[model samples]
Structures are given as structure tokens and as C-alpha cells.
Target: MENTEFRVELVRLVDESYPVVVGRDLEGSVAEFLADKHPDRRAAVITDSNVASLAAEGLLSSFGSRPADLVVFPAGEASKTREVKERVEDELIARGFGRDTVIVALGGGVVTDLAGFVAATFTRGVPYVSLTTTLLGAADAAIGGKTAVDTPAATNLIGAFHQPAAVFIDLDRWLTLSDRQIREGLGETVKHACIADAVFFEALEDAFVERGLSPAEFVRDDALAELTARRNCEIKRDFVTSDVHEGNRRMGLNLGHTIGRALETAAGYTLNHGECVAIGLALQSRLGERLGYCSPSDVARIEALLRAIGLPTKIPEEVPVDRIMEAMAHDKKGKAGAIRFVFQDGVGRLVVHDGGSYARPVAAEDVHAFLQSQV
Candidate 1:
């Protein structure tokens, strides 16, 4: 029998690697960065109503002689919907924006997600940059190429893998974040540490304890904040580079996101994403212990770190467990009503399930039992 043979040439779909500028006072560099990276593109700064007057203004001012426009939507998670994406896209069309337009996401996770979806779909796809304002945006949302808007059914259910032209992390922007917003960012930072870097987790813990700072206060500390932002980006970069399309290996990055997204959807946009993720991490870590994949001490340690940062560890009494489970069943990671959960073997490591998938189908009964324990 002749072996099947075919010549395969490697074709690179994405030719350029964008820079992630992480530092204080990086606002001055935005225009220069755009000039260097996308000199001919028209700029469309997409921000939320809350951020329009804050970091958004600074970003627009930095545009210098470059042609740019601002599109601000109502602030909050409720705005991260298909309706909002369409509205922004319509604004771009009405303004005569073309394929050469560059979308600048100028707020937290929601803005990035919505504006990114718009960029991803506009004229098929367009270049975009993230000028992250909130800590959550800096640490996670703005880094990975993953972009999406929420649907009535689930969080980020409809989206695309549209890489940004660049990502700007201006540390000074975080000063304007509320304490709750700071905690929201810490949620992703903690997940990054738990999934891949024990040392990072310890560093964050030590920083909080040594300085005697609450989670919110700790996020405001210059030294710790910078380190956290840089480290989280590095960890995410490793995952994204290893598996740009999520395939299997990158699914490890979804450690707590499986259940976390469910909680966010069930809460109806009330619980900020990072807050819901903190709860998901705590519950999943506990589940890992129950399944004998990790030690009870592991669960306790994770919960303690999250609590230290003022993140909630338990399911809110008001959020329905059944609703969460239903949402989990419909999660993008799941298939045919089966829920795929990513569990940790220990801090800084994910447990590879028997089939070698980073995601495992856990029994609904087991998940229900765990939720009951949480309350």
C-alpha cells in the first residue's frame, strides 16, 4: 500500500507580533506606537461612558495630528452585547470609516470585548489596540487575542480570535479604579498564579501581607502592581503562543473560567467578571480536593489568597446554583450538554484528565453537590 503523501507549506496567517507596552506614563507613547505600527489607519477610540472622561481623554489627546474618532457607550457589563457591537459598527460606517481603520479599546474588559468584536467583524477584520484602563483589562482581557461580545444565553458565547495590533498598559490609569475594580483585576492575576506560577502566587501573597495592604490597597501599590501586570501578561503570552486557537494545551488557561462564566451569566451582569471568577476558582479548587486530585490544604490556600484580596470565595446566596449549572452545560468549552471543567493538581499546575484533554467532563451530580457545599 502506498502511504498517503502531500506537500504542506507553512503559511503564516498573522505576520506581525505586536508589542505590549507595560509601564507608567505610557500615554505619551500611544500616538508614536500607532504611527510606527499602523501609520495609515484611521483611529476609532471605543470606550465606555465611565471611561470617556478619564483615560479615554488622555488616549485621544495623545493621538496628536492623527485622524481619530471617539465612540462611547453606556458603562457596565450590560453594554457588552451584540446590540452594542452593532451600534458601534454603525457609528464607524456612518463616519465613513473603512478597512484601514484601527479600533482602540479604551476601557476595561467589556469595552475590549465589544470593541474587539466590532474590529474583528468590521470589513471582515481590522487592526485594533487595547489601551487598558482597569487592572482587569491590563492583566488579562487586553492581552490575549480572544475577543467577543455576550449573548442573552452566555458570556462571550459569540466572538473571534482577533489579535490586536498592540496592547498598552499604562499603570497610571489604574489609579482611577475603584476598590471593587481593583479586586476584579486581582481575580485574573490570582488565576494566572494558580494555573502556572506558584512563585507569582507567593509573591502576591507576600506583597499583601508584608505591606499589610488589603486586596484593593495592594493593587494600588506601585511595586506590586507593576510586577503583577507584567507577570500575568507573560504567563498569558506563553499560553497564547503555545496554542493560539485554544485547541487543547491552551485550555489550561481556562482553569476557573469554565464555571466562572456560568456564574457571571447567572448573575445577570451584576457580579463583575473578575469577582465571579474568584468564586469559580475557589469552588473548583475545592472540587479538585473532593476528587482527590489535590490536597485540602491546596483548596484552603487558594481561598485564603482570594479572600485576602477581598474577592468572594463562595457562591453568592442570591445566585441560583441550577442556573449556573445550566449555563455551564452550554459553555463553549462544553459539548452536547456535557460540562468540561479544568481542575488543578496543585498550585501552578493543571491536572491533565485521563483522555489528555485539559478539559474534563465532570458529572452533573458532582458539580451540584459541590455547589450545595458552597452555600
Candidate 2:
């Protein structure tokens, strides 16, 4: 996309009272956006070591007159935990971070989630801005007010709904991703398309033809990718707007996240979240097809898109289907011994399983069948 022509509007959710600014290279513009609200002489940035060298310099440079401190954590999903969150909090406190101080997160989903949680808890909530560096972070994780860290028992069971003051997405950072990383991010985008827009889904099919292209290459000429991101953001924004606390509407965004989270935990936090979601989405689609909620063609298209993006459409070979099902039973969405799921009736239409009304409750047999079909 031509840098001059590409424009990302600032979306402000009145309910959450947070503004989302989307644009290429918006990371460089963070200082200006937070200048008025942040009069504190010093700010602390929490980011992973992997991204610190790449993103930290530009962000620090943007601070200019304002002093910025850097706290670097080890990269990967495993780093998102209570221990990590406490360490970050201590760093913030040692730096004399007052209520006026801002916490800037510069990395992928894990960084944003951990740092944002720390920001929320520190001094009973200080302002923070999400400078997302990955596709999943940009399109989903960073937008919503959800911030969390994992526990030994479950993923994201410990967290808070803390909205950032602003979100800055730099499309330029995406250029640094490997093919595998890009494909992982595409999983979230695909989920958004499947749940919200059919056109966006088709657009992703075209972009992933050659194992994903650079942001500039794809976003510049491919209007669809840009549109898909925007549309996906809108879907999430509306959901959060209605249920900022994830009381109702926000549950829709958890379409495949229930099973996805379980898979991540089962993998001992070794798998990327988007990769797990890709598998979860496929499993859900297969279940939907078997239950007659979605057609076989729809399931095929979903799996094909995931594969084209280099995502694993099936569960990992190491994980047993029964274990995955057992984990699913403990999902956050499950209620009163019944597991609930968000299944699609068709493109852009989702129905939450409500105590086996029209939708039959998926049993262990069905899950095993779905798993077998995928392998």
C-alpha cells in the first residue's frame, strides 16, 4: 500500500473510554498521542528481549525529552505469568512510576497481555498504550481491553479487563516476521473473517497463496487485507463495546478460543496461540459440520485457508484427542457440567450452544471423530 494513501482511522469506544489508533508506522507516533495525558517526567516500557532491540530504539527515540526506562523479558508465551507480571510491576515501582506515568508495551500478544496486566494492577491502574508488533496482536489481542497472564492450572485464568489509553499498530514491524510467524497471525484473521465477513475470508485466501507476503506488498495493493483487519477490529470493538467485561457479546469473540486455550495449555505453552486457534477453529468447524450447523464445503474452505497460510489445521500429533476433550471440559465457557461452544450456522452467523437446544451437545465420541477427520 502507498504510505500516503493508506489511512487508519482512530476508533474510540465510548463504553471503554479508550481510543484505538490504527496505521502503518503508528508506533513512531506514540509519544505525540500520549503527550497530553502523560506529563510524568518518566515512563517505563515493558517488552520482550527479542523485540527490544528492534522496536525499543524507535520508541525511546520518540520519547525525545521524556525519560523512558526499558524492562525486557524473555520472549515467548511462557514468559506471560504471575512471576513475570510481578517482576514487571517491581520494575515499574522501582522506577517511581506514579499514577501519571505511562506503561508502554512494545511486542506481540504475550508482551501486551503481560505488560497491560501490570499496568492495570500497578497503583490500581495507570495509563498504558499498546504498540502491537504482531498480526494477532494488531488485529485482536491489543484492541480489546483484556489483559492476562497464564497460571499452572489454566491459561488467562488470572487477569483483568483493563483498557489501554491507546493502541499503536505498526505494519512495518510485520515485515520482520518469518513465514511461520505470519501464518500464526493469519489464524486470528481467518477466525475474524469466518465469524464476521465472508468477503474478508475470500481475500485472505488470495493473500496466503505464496506463504504470505510482506505488509507493504500485500497491504499496498491488496485492499482486502487492509479491509479485513479493519473489519475484524470493528467486530471486536462492537463486541467489547456492548460487553466490555466479556459478560455477553464478548463471548462471541471466544468462538474457538475455548478449545484453543486448552490446546495451548496441553502443549505446555510451547505452541503459538494463533496456531492453537487454527486447530481449534478447524475442530469447531468439523463439529459444526457433523452437527449440521455448517456445510461440509464451509469446513473445507476454512481448513484450506488455514493450510494455505502454512497453519496446522489439525491437532498436534503428540496430543491425544481424549486429553484435548478433557481439557475442553474445563474451559472457562463451560457451565454447570455442560461445555458451551460458539458454532457457525453459516458465514457470519454464530450460535452459542445453550444447554442442548437446537444444537446437540458434542460428546467425547463426536470430538474423537472430529479429531480423526482432521488427521
Candidate 3:
């Protein structure tokens, strides 16, 4: 037998980049940030009901003499839909805001995702900034420029790779978040540590054992939250800049997202994104151990850290494994019937498939078996 190999080159002319500003009292600085970033553009502020009251209104008022428009939607994963996207776009059109408009997303992950999606599509892509209020948005959703809206078929099914002009993480805003919301952000904060930095994982462990740090305490401690948020952003910046289109190392950022997203969709948006991600990390770590990519001790440590941070490490009895598997089939990482997954080689290292895919396709039966083990 003879061996044959072929190579293909795909070049993308992506020059998009943005600054992630993490600090306390950032709400008061939104106007300064926007004025310097998009000085001449009109502003279209997009936020949810909850955030509108807590941060959006304050942000708009901070704009001072700057002219701006405001649009508030009901808060939740449900609002990240095509219908909302259309309504938002129609409102912008009705107000006569053109491409010169700068969409300002002031809220949590949902607002950032939805507003970014709107910014990407409206008038063939306008500029946008992500002023995140929640920890989840600051740590994960607001940084990478992966804007999206959910669909009945799946979550984040319709979206675009539109980077923001800038991302602002207001540490003071954590004061307004419920404890549950802070915990949701920890789901991703722990995930970034598990997949990218072992020392970060250890620091998180120290925060728990020595400093008595927990998700509940995140709101009470701005210094700790700022450190965690900044590290997550640095890791994400490295990945997105290295592989903007998710062609290689960037996909590794989806460490637990394969199953995580499925859990979110299967739960019908009832489960918080980070809650589902915490469960997904638990299940995926076990799967990694089963396939010899990760050690059992490492899996145990991962679960323990997640638990210590006030995150759930097990699939809820309410969310059926079968339903989750069905949802995974429609995940964006799937090709034909093969679902691509990113597994950890160890803490801080990711498994790269023989074909150079950060995410490798696993058989459906294998996935089903993995799911079964969780139950």
C-alpha cells in the first residue's frame, strides 16, 4: 500500500481587533470610552429590562451631551431570537440610524450576544461596544467577538464573527448581580483555567481554601473579580487573535461547550449558560478520562474546583441525557453526523487530533455512552 497526503491553504483577511478594558467604576467611564472609540457615530443602546434599570440607564445618562437611542428587551435567553433581532433592526431603521450608528451593548452575555448580532447585520455591519455588567459577560461572552442569537433548533445557531470596537468590564456592576449570576460567571472562569492555565486553576483553588473565596463572595470582592476577569480576557484574547475563525487553537476555547451548549438547548433556556457549562465540564472531563486524554485525578480536581466555586458538577435529573445528545447533533461544530469535541490533554494542554483539528469527531455511540455514564 502507498500513502498519500494532500494539503490545502485557506487565507482569511481578518484584521479585526478590540481592547478589553477591565476595571472598577467602568460604568462612569462608558462615555469617555465611547467618545474616544466612536466619537462621531450616533449611539444605539441595547439592553434588557433588568440591565436597563441597573446599568443601561446609568450608562446612557453617562453619555452626557452625546446623542443616543435606547432599546430595552425582556431579560432572559428567550430574547436572543430572530424575532428580537428583527424588531431591534426595525426600530433602528425607524429611528433613521444608519451604518454610522454605534451599537452599545450594556448588560450581560445575552445583551452582548444579541446586540453584537444586530450590529453585525444591520446596514451591513456597524460598529459596536460591549459594556458588560455580569461576570459571565465580562469573563467570556463579551471578549471574543462571537456574536449570536438562539434558534428553536439550537442555541447560537444564527450569528456572525463580528468583533466589537471595544469591551468594557465594570467591576462595580457586580454589586447589582444576584449571587446566582456571579456563580454562572464562575462556570466559565473555572473553565478558562482548566483548559488554558494550570496556575490559574491553582490560584482559584487557593482563593477557595485560603481566602474563603466563593461565587457568593465574588460580588463582595472587586479585587478578586477583577483578577479573574482580566485573566479570562487575556486567555481569550490569545485564542481569538491566534485563530479568529476557529480553525485551530481557537476551537480549544470550546473546551466544554460541545456538551455545554447541548445542555442549554435541551433545557430550553431554563438552565443558566454557566450552570450548563459547569455540568458539561464535569461530563466532558469524565469523557476525557474514559478516552485516556485526561487522568481520573484531574477530572476529580476539576469537579471539586467547580463545586468549591458554588457550581453544580452533575447533570440535573430534569435534563435528560438523550435530549442533550439530540441537541449536540445540531451543534455548529458538527459536520454531517460527526460531532467535533475539544478534550483536555491535561490541565493547561488540549488534545489535538491527528488531522490537526482542535475538535475531533466522536462517534454517536461513544457520545451516547458518555452521556449514559453521567446518569
Candidate 4:
């Protein structure tokens, strides 16, 4: 038998921060954590239809109590809404669950977000654990503890900051994801390296672009997957812990999200989050070129890596440029009449303005022109 446990990372906050165990074959360790930490608490596992039959089933069986499972909401970004959340909460109530329940979020980012939200409010706050099975969740979403569901007006409009008791990045399950899923998750992986960890960024380029290894191949290599996932969490933790609740400090983490999220909304969610972020990253690099934040070579290198990883570096023709512009104005980070973009200085570097803000206000007209030029 292989002993699979490895290093653990901590978020470290003002009040309390929890440990994130990063490794492969984490099912046994996850079960042990809940058993020792929660004792008699019932785990009301939450996941979506896509994941209910996957890791969720095994995770539930691992529970010492063999605790009852949870409802399988329809999967996809569409399910990340208030209506689905209301129904999940209702189902838990009907099952007689209470404050003693422990939320086991056993899927990708969607499950992590929706389930964590349920924990934040159910009985006014119950402990939760994230067995993040997807590469996206493992690299980014599952670590932050920011929980929310979307509304028609915008994404994640209603949410709370409820950190999990523990987080497990189960790399064993990540192997089950498709090649496209692997590429999508690398959007965050690349984003993590772009903002911090220059060495990690170069390594990604060398492996996926220069040497021509595919995203799927990279993730399948245990050594590569473990190091990449671990680095992503560390970069995220560095920013999140310093500004847990609200501070301009953590805004740097939004590197490509500002435009990426807007494009996602404009595209009507047809494009997955990671795909949209890849485009946003390319666009930001272009903007950097125009603004002298980065050179033409920098833009080329960034776009080449994104393309090599099987991600989109250009805005799709089907997604109207004007709609993307409109969505930006409504971005949650937008101030007054301007959108503050987290621009890049170059590959592996983000721009921080003289005012000490990671994102700076860009003229909407300039952004409009940039969109026009791209199309």
C-alpha cells in the first residue's frame, strides 16, 4: 500500500485559519479529519448531478457514520443560482439536518461555492470541508472560502466569507477530469504563476509550450500536478490571508477575472470560467502592450502559452464586442463610471499603480477600441 499523504498549507488569518491538505488519494485522510474533528456531526454532503455519482459517493461511504448524502442539483454554471441554493437548503431542512451538520463539498468550483454557502447560513453557520476534486477547485476556488450563488443581475452577487474547517485537494480524483477540463483548470494555474511565482510560470511554458507536452499530460504526472496545485494555493493564500475580509490588497488576485467574468456574462455562460479567463489574460496583455506595461514579446509569450495549453487567446466572434463592453461596466469591481482592470506588467508580473492599487481605472472608450480592434 502506498502512503499518499504529503505537505499541508495554511491560510493564516486574524481570527482563525485552517489547514489545506494537498495530495493524491486523499479519501482516507479526509474521512479521518472529519471523524477526529467533528466526532458525531452528521455530514450533509452537497454536490451536483455531474459529481453526485463520482467522488461524492466514495466520500460519503468513507464517513465513519456513513452519514446520509445530499441532493444532486442540476450541474453546470446555471445551477449556481439562488433558486438551486434555496432548493438544496430546503432539502436539508426536510431531512432534519441542523447546526450539527457538516457540509462536505465534494465537487468542483460550483459545488465548493454552493455547498460552502449552505454551510455559512445553515443553522447560522456549520462547519464544512472541501474535498475539491476538480483541477480548478484544487488550484483556486476551494481555497478562498468565498461562498456565493449567482443572480441574473450578476455572478456571486450574494455570498459570505465562511472559511472551511479543512480543505483537501484530492489529486487522485482530478485524474478523472477530461482534457478540456484539465486545460480549463490551467487557466487559474497560469493565472497564479502570472501574478506571482515567476519560476512556476517559466516551468509551465517550458513544459506545455516549449517542450510541447499537453495539459492533460502535465496533470497526469504526479510530480507536476502536486507542485502546480501546491503553488497555486500558496499564491492565493499569500494574498487572501493578508486581506481576509475586505481590503484593496487582495484585489491583485483578480488579475484576469475583471474582463474574464464580464465576457462570461456577455457570452451567456456558454464559455466556461477558465476559457473566458484565458481570453481576458490575452486581452490584458494586449492592453499592457498598448500602455507600455509589457512589450510585444511579452504578449506573444503569454498568448503562446495559453494557446499551447488549449485555451482561447482571442475573444470569440460569436460573443459581441458591445455586450462584453456593457458587462464590464457592471463588473462588481467597477467604480462609479470606470472599470479598474488588473493589468499586467509582463509575463509573471502584474502592474501596481503609483496609488498602490493593483488594478487601475482604464478609459471605457479605450477598452471599446481595443475590443473593436480584436474583432
Candidate 5:
């Protein structure tokens, strides 16, 4: 059978343009692409424990020659740390791998982020490619070159901006994901639509809200998968092309990520990243309503779509509101010593603050009050 593919060219803020390829059963195509692109560079596969078996073989095959090594770490958000990063670097060094190695992140978001950071500092910088395995990675994590590890303080407080030479989001790899995982990815999907493409937002409403289908019911729906993969990369491309380092307009991509990261970090990652963002998407839309940037119905529609897709639209009781606030204080998005957030202007567009930044600073006390009310 012939393979169908969706390609988005990402012209990053630095260096040459990179291609993001989205397709199902893409191992063969990926091999040819990577071999052509980096023929002389040695290859290294950096992944996690759970994804090592699933990712190594195909990725090693992409190099045309045997890879230098497979660097696997523990497979969860917890492993997204400086320590794990050090270990990965140490292994690569001990194996004689160096600056000429093109790191292949062959797992989910964690691998992409951690390995990209490793690439950023390894011999001052080396190139990497993303073989993103999970739907969440395909939706939000794999693109944009925003790679980082978490500290006790905040999510992504310690990281770097290092673009990959290319990205491959293989839909076939995501078939192993559970239903909740699919919903988590959809949360980001809905977020991308909410911020840039009103038509995409309406398409999501039609599929998940009006039709009322579980994300799993359409798990094998290739057309929907292709649409989602392409749109995710394309929407992100708009931001990275302009602000690769996230200096200005790129903050628009954080519409649901502000409160989402704080809560997830505070919750000690007990919550899935996508689910927390779903809650944040709902909360921020409501905050937008409070500021008159959007209508109440707009907020309701956002929450309804999230709920219809089986994502959590409310904060869990166990995660303290105060802790979430504390984490937000440490967020990388802070400006003027105030916590700024990216809020939506109705369903499909983001609000640009009067201060010239795409995000605005709402009083911390106000955010606390609103969060307390949600409990």
C-alpha cells in the first residue's frame, strides 16, 4: 500500500528551514529522509525505557549505518530532569559520541525535550531530529524547538531553544496509546484550533462535540489524524517562524499552558500534561470572559468541547490552589514580576495585550480568587 503524508516546512528563526513529516507507517520514508539529510553525521537514539523497544530499531535503520548507541532513560515526566540529562550526556561521552552526532529523539515529549536540550549543550550545540512517538508530542511537544527540563520551581525553568533538523510524527506509533492519552493529546489539538484557526475549532466541535464520539471510537481514523498532525505543525510553524526564542508573538501559543504548567508542576505531575492543559484552556477562557475579551458562551463552548472529548475541565481536589499559584510565580512566562497569561478572544483567536506582548498580566490575587472559586 502507498503511504499518504502531510508535510509542513518550518522556517525557524535561526539557520535553515526544517521539514516536519506526518504520516502513518512512516519508518521506511523516515529512513530515506534522514539518510539523505544527514549522510555523514553519526546517529544516536535518545529515548526512554518504555519507548526503547518500540523506537530503536526503526530509528537506527534511518542512519544507513549502525547508530553509535541507544540512550534510554526512565520513561515519565519525572525523568525530565538535569540528572537524567547528565546521565544521557555521560553515556554518549563514554561511548565516544560527540558534536558530529545527530541525536534522534525517538520517544514522546520527554525524549524530544531532554534530548534536544542535550543537543543544545553537547559540544556547545549539535543537530537533532524528532521521531516523536506519542500524540501529545505530535500535537505540542515535538515542534517549536522549546526544549527544557523541570526544576522543583516550575516547568521548563531550565532548558534551551534548539531546533531539530527534521521531525517525524508517526501516527502508527500512537496506536498503542490508551484512551485517556488520546484525550490528552486532543486537549492540545483543541488549544491549537482555539488560538489560530476558527475553522479548525469548528471542525473539532463537529467531530467531538456534535457527534459525541469517544476519541477511541475514531482511533483508526486516518483522515482526522492527518488533519490534526498537519494543523498542529502548521499552527506552531506560524509562531516559531516569527519568534523562535519565544520573545514576543510566540507567547500566543501559551493560551492554555500558563495555568496548565503551574498546576501540573505543582501537582508533581500527578496529572497528565494534556489533561491539565484542558483544565487551563477552560479556566483561561473564563478569565477572558471576566476581562470582556470573550463572551460567556465562548467559555462554555470551550469547556463543553473539552468535556465531550473526555478531558478534565476542572481542577482535581487534591491539587492545592496555593501550590499552583506558587508554581506560576516561577514560570518562565513571568514579566515585570507579574504572572502573565495568554487568554483567548472567543473561540478561534488570541487576545493581544495593550502592553505589546501577546500575553497580559492579571493581578496574582485575581488569579488566586478565580482559582479558589473553581474548587
Candidate 6:
């Protein structure tokens, strides 16, 4: 990819603020952003082994003359845990990092969440920037102030909302991803389109068919992919700006996350976050239609797009529905023993339903029935 530039606006969450800068070659720009925000002359970078080699090198090179440290974690969601957090914190302390130090997260959502949490809690919070390398991170996880580490019982159970100083998105990294990783990111992209922009969703569907593109090709076209990324980020920004703490409107972003999170835990963190989210989106759309929130045609469209993009539109055969529901009971969104779900009223609109009134929240019976319909 030649030199390319694109702009993504800043979203100021209540009591926090961060800029989401989307462009090519943003690895170098991260240093400039950090210098302006925290010129304290010391910083630490937390990244997974896989991404550290591919992406973190550019970021480290960018911080010329500044004192910086690198901390590596295992490369997967399983690393987002108490053990990893303790290790990262220990490294920071051993390095003699003070409150003046900044943390640069240089990987996917898991790295950003775990590292950002460390930055947020260490010495009552220090500055950090999000150098998102994955598409899912760039579109959703990286921009939102929400950071977390997972517990044995639930995913992202222990966490905080620590907004980053800035988010630098380098589209060039998309070219290096395997087809599977690219498909994983498309799941979230589809979610954004379903909940916020019908036009964007339709455009992607048309493009998928027209070019005979795989998920990898679809997301690597910098111009087209960046448009989708910006749209998803904007959807999240609008909600976060209105309900910064996720007290209300912002909860809509959890549309498929309720089931998605449950699926992750049920799979023992084996399923990719975006892949679980893809299945959750399909399930939720079916539920929406059953509840009169959407038309059958809309649900079909969603399923078709996900399938075309190489995402799983149904729950894995190995995981039973009962196990998934049991996991849902432990979701962070559940309250008073009832799981709360962000369902849709239609494309681009959402409704949050309390689970207490229904036996298997999200009307698991209804969801199961819908699944049968798909089969």
C-alpha cells in the first residue's frame, strides 16, 4: 500500500477523552501523539508475541531517543487473565516506572484490554495509547474506553473504562492477516452495519458478491475497508458520547455480545471473540424477527452476509444450547439473576430486554426455535 491517509474523529467519553486516528503508516504517528500527550520521556509497550514482531517494531522505532520498555504476553485471548496482569504490573514496577510513564498497547483487543487495565489501575492511572493492529480492535474494542481482564467464570468480568490518550490505526497491517483472522473481524463489521447503518451493510453485501472476495480480500482493500471501520467506530462513538459509562444507550453496543461472551466462556476461551460474535448476531437477529423487531428478510440478509464472509452463522455443533445458556447466566450484563440482552427493533435500532420475566432469557426457547428454522 502506498502512502494513504484517512481521518477518524475523537470521541470524548464522559470523564475521559481519546482520539481515534485511522490511516496508513500510523505506527510512526503514535510517537508524535504520545509526545504531545505525555512528554515524560518514559513509556512501556505491552503486546502479544505474534504482534510484537510484526507491528510493535514500528512503534518502538518511532519513539526515537525516548526511554521505553517492551513486555510480551502469550498470543491469544487466554492471556487476558489475572496471571498476565500480574506479570505485566511486575515488569512495570521492576522498570522503575512512575506515574509519569505511558503504556502503548500494540496488538489486538486482548492486549489493549489487559494492558490498558494495568495502566488504569497502576498508581491511580497513567496515560496509554491504543496502537490497534487487528480489524476488530480498530473498529470497536480499541476506540471504546472499556478495558478488562477475564475471570474463570466469565469473560471480561474484571475490568474498567480507562480511555486511551489516542488510538492509531495502521491499515497496512490488515494485509498480513490470515484469512481466518480477517473473517473474524468481519463479524464485528457486520454487527456495526446491522445496528447502525443499513446502507453500509448493503454495500458490503454487494461488494462481497461483485468481487467474489473472501473476507481477507474484502478487509484488505484499504479504501473500502477503512470506510467500514470508520462507520463502525462512529456507531460506537455516537453511543459512547451519549452514554459514556454504558448506563443506557451505549448498552446497545452489546447487541450480540451477551451471547458472544457466553459462547467464549463455554468454549473455554477457545473460540475467537469475533467468531462467537458472528454466531450471536445471527441468533439475535432471529430473535428480533420473532419478537416483531425485524422482518424475516432482514434476518436472512444478515445470515447470508455472514456466510459469504466466511463467518459461522450458527452455534458450533460441539457446543450445546443448554451450555450456552448456562454461560449466559454468568454474563456481566446479567442483573438480579436475569440476563439482559441488546436485541434489535429493526436494522439500525436496538432494544434491551430484561431476562427475569422469561425462563431462558433472550427467550432461549425462541432462540432455539429460530435456530431450528435456520437448519
The candidate that achieves the highest TM-score relative to the unseen native structure: 4
Q: Which model is ahead, 1 or 2, in terms of TM-score?
A: 1
lDDT per residue (tens digit) for residues 116-208 in model 2: 998888888877888888877877887778899999886688999888988777777777877667667777888888777787777777776
For model 4, how big is the CA root-mean-square deviation?
9.0
Compose the digit string of candidate 1's lDDT tens values, residues 22-97.
Answer: 8888867888988987899999999999889877767778888888999999998789998988899999999999
The per-prediction CA RMSD against the true structure, in angstroms, equals 3.9, 9.8, 5.7, 9.0, 9.0, 9.6
Clashing pairs in 1: none
Native-to-model Cα distance after best TM-score fit, residue 103 in candidate 2, in Å: 1.2
TM-score of 5: 0.88
Poorest 10 consecutive residues by lDDT, candidate 4: 60-69
Give stretches of model 3 more than 4 Å off.
1-14, 334-339
The count of residue-pair clashes in candidate 1 stands at 0
Model 1: residues with Cα > 4 Å off, grouped in runs:
1-12, 267-269, 334-338
Clashing pairs in 6: none
Off by over 4 Å in 2: 1-15, 209-225, 267-270, 335-338, 352-360, 369-374
Model 5 agreement with the true structure over 1-375: per-residue lDDT tens digits: 999999899964546578889988777776676578777777778999988877677666655554557888999989999999999999999999877888888888988999999999999999898988888899988888889998877557899888888999888887888898888889899999999999988878888889887766655788888888889889989987898766889888888889999989888888888998999999998888988988988988898889889889988999999999988887767654467888888888888777777888888888899999999
**Per-residue lDDT over 256-351 for candidate 4, one digit per residue giving the tens place of the 0 to 100 score:** 888899899899888888999999888888887898898999888889989999899888999999899888887768766667888777777778
- Listed per model in order, the count of residue pairs whose N, CA or C atoms clash below 3 Å is 0, 1, 0, 0, 0, 0
Model 6 C-alpha lDDT per residue in residues 3-76, reported as the tens digit of each score: 99898998754556667888888866888877787886488999999998897777788889887899999999
| lDDT-better candidate, 2 vs 5 | 5
List lDDT for all candidates, in order: 0.85, 0.77, 0.85, 0.85, 0.85, 0.80
Cα lDDT for residue 83, model 6?
Answer: 90
- Worst ten in a row by lDDT for model 2: 355-364
| Structural similarity to truth (TM-score) of each candidate | 0.89, 0.85, 0.88, 0.91, 0.88, 0.87
